[model samples]
Target: MLGGISIWQLLIVLGIIILIFGTKKLRNVGGDLGGAVKGFKKAMNEDEKGNDKSTDDPQARVSHDDEGTTYDVKAERKAEEQDERK
Candidate 1:
C-alpha cells in the first residue's frame, strides 16, 4: 500500500536485510549511530556556550571568515602587537 509495496513485501525486504547483516551486527551499528548522535549534540551545546561566553566578554570579539573560521579580535590584536614588537 506504500508506493505500490504491500506490508508483506516490506516484511520480506526487512527479513532479507536482517539475514544479510545478522542481529548482532545490526545492534552494534545502531549503538554506534546513537553514540555519534549524542556526541554531535554535545558538541553543539558546547559551541553555543562558547559563543555566549564570547559575547559576554567585552574584550572578546568573535568574527567569522569566508571559510567559516572564527577569530577572536582581542587575541588577534595582542598577537599583532607582539609581532610588531618583534
Candidate 2:
C-alpha cells in the first residue's frame, strides 16, 4: 500500500535484504550513519553561532602565534649550477 507496492511486498524485500547483509552489519551501518548525522547537526549549529558572533563584531580578527615555527626551505641554486645540471 505504499507507492504501488503492497505491505507484503515490502516485507519480502526487507527480509531478502536482511538475509543478504545479516543483522549485525546492518546495525553497525545504521549506527555509523546516525553518528555522522549527529556530528553534521552539531557542526551546523556551531557554524550558525559563529556567524552570529562575527556579524555582531565586524572588527574582530583571528590571530595566530608563530613564535617557534620553522618552515622547510631549499637553498637557491646559482645559474652556474643550473647550467652544469643541464
Candidate 3:
C-alpha cells in the first residue's frame, strides 16, 4: 500500500499549481497569506478589549434637529438679509 503520496501525485499537484499561478508569484503568496492571518488575530484581540469604536459608544452623542444648528451659514445670512431689508 502506498501510504505516502507517489512522485506522480506530487508532480501533478505541483503542475496544477504552477499552471494556475506561476512559481515566482506563488512565492509571495505565502507571505501575503501569513500577513492576513496575523491581521485577523490582531483584530480579534482588539475586539476582545472592547475598543472597536466603529459601533456607537456610550460617551458619544450626536444631535439632530429640524431647527438645525447655529452653524447653518446660509440660514443665518438669509435671516440677516431679511432683518436688514426691514
Candidate 4:
C-alpha cells in the first residue's frame, strides 16, 4: 500500500534488519552521525561570523597564497591615504 510495499512487508524488512545489526550497533551509528552533523553546523556558523566581521573592516582582510612571494593588500589603501594628505 505504501511505495509499492505493504505494511506487513515493511515490518518484515525492519525485523530482519534489527535482527542482523542489533540495537547496540544501530545506536552507535546514530550517535556518530549526530556528532558529525553537529560539528559541520558549528564550522559553518563560525565561518559565517568571520566573514561578517571582515566585510565591515578592511584591515581585517587576509590574503593567502602557496608561493613564497609576499603581497601587501593594504598598499592601495596607503596610496589613497597619501593622496588625501596631499
Candidate 5:
C-alpha cells in the first residue's frame, strides 16, 4: 500500500500511466514539467517587478519612432507633399 493510498491503488494508477504512455515517453514528460515550472517562476518574477512602479531603472532604452531622430513631424510632412508635387 502507498503511505497515503493503498499500495494497490498506487500500483494501478502507475500501471495506467505506463500503459497510456511508455517509460521513454514518460521520461520526456519530466523535461516538459520542469519547463512549465521554470516558466511559472519567470512569470511570477515578472509580475513582482511589474507591481513595483517606482523603479525607473531600465536595463536598456527602447526608443519609439522619432525618439532620437532630429526630423520634425511638420517639416517631414511638408517635404513629403513637395516631393509628391514634383
Candidate 6:
C-alpha cells in the first residue's frame, strides 16, 4: 500500500491516465522525455572535456567588448569594487 492506497487503487489511477492521454500520445511524450535526458547527459560530458582545455589557454580568459577593447576581466571587476568604496 502506498499513501494508504491499495494496489487496486493505483491500477485504477494508472488506467485513468492512459485513457485520458491515449497510448500514442503517451508514447510520444515518453520518447520526447527520453531524448531530452540523453541530450542533457551528452552536453554535460562535453562541458567537462572542454573546460579543461579552455582554462589552460590564456586568451580564452579575456572577454572582448563590442568596441574591440580587451580587458583582464577578473582584475577589472576587483578595481570596480574598490572604486565603489571611495
Q: Which candidate has the highest lDDT of all?
A: 6
Worst 10 residues of 2 by lDDT: 71-80
Which candidate has the highest TM-score of all?
A: 2
Where is model 1 more than 4 Å wrong at Cα? 55-86
Q: Please write out the lDDT profile of model 6 over residues 1-86, one tens digit for every residue.
A: 46799999999998999999999999999999999999999999988998889877788877666676667999999999999998
- TM-score to true structure, per model: 0.57, 0.63, 0.44, 0.55, 0.49, 0.61
lDDT of 2: 0.84
Candidate 5 structure quality by residue, lDDT tens digits, 1-86: 34679878888999999999999999899889999999999999987897685456463355466767676899989999999999
In model 4, where do residues sit more than 4 Å from their true spots? Answer: 55-86
Q: Can you list the residue pairs that collide in candidate 5?
A: 1-7, 2-7
Model 3 scores a C-alpha lDDT of 0.84
Clashes of each: 0, 0, 0, 0, 2, 0
Which residue pairs of candidate 6 clash?
Answer: none
Off by over 4 Å in 5: 1-5, 54-86
lDDT of 4 at 45: 97
- Residue-level lDDT tens digits of model 3 in 1-86: 27888989988999999999998899899889999999999989988776667456665555555565357789889999999999
Q: In lDDT terms, how accurate is model 1?
A: 0.89
| Position 68, candidate 4: lDDT | 83
Candidate 2's C-alpha runs over 4 A off are 55-86
Query: Can you give the lDDT of residue 47 in candidate 1?
Result: 81
Which window of ten consecutive residues has the lowest lDDT sum in model 4?
A: 57-66
lDDT by residue for model 2 (10-65), tens: 99999999999999999999999999999999999998888878846645754456
The 0-to-1 C-alpha lDDT of every candidate, in the order given, reads 0.89, 0.84, 0.84, 0.88, 0.85, 0.90
